[model samples]
Target: MVIKGGILLAIRYNSHRYTRDIDFSTNQMLGDINKDEIANRLNKSMAIMGESL
Candidate 1:
């Protein structure tokens, strides 16, 4: 997780809000990580959450 490496924030808005993109915020340590890492980590998180499904 980026937060593990020092990402300090995160924000996500619903697509139903009429926005074209989800809004995100972070004090992410980009040099230490990148978009793919964030996405993959989030996906893995979702997989864990979805195990209940």
Candidate 2:
């Protein structure tokens, strides 16, 4: 996934804007992927990083 929107702007440009959520872009189409599986994987990754969904 690629990060975008307010979060990206804040990091890249050092903007002071506050954002409550993250935005992402994927190369695969939504219809071609299992969202639940992806969510599980992402959650696991976050857990490994000491973060949570």
Instruction: Report lDDT (CA) for all predictions.
Output: 0.53, 0.81
- Highest lDDT among the candidates is held by which one? 2
lDDT (10s digit) by residue, model 2, range 1-53: 88788867876899888497888889998899898997898788768866522
lDDT of 1: 0.53
**Pairs with steric clashes in candidate 2:** none
User: For model 2, what is the C-alpha lDDT against the true structure?
Assistant: 0.81
Tens-place lDDT per residue, model 1, 1-53, is 22321222222332233423344556656687677877898899869868966
* Clashing pairs counted in every model: 0, 0
Residue 22 accuracy (lDDT) in model 1: 45
- Residue-level lDDT for 34 in candidate 1: 74
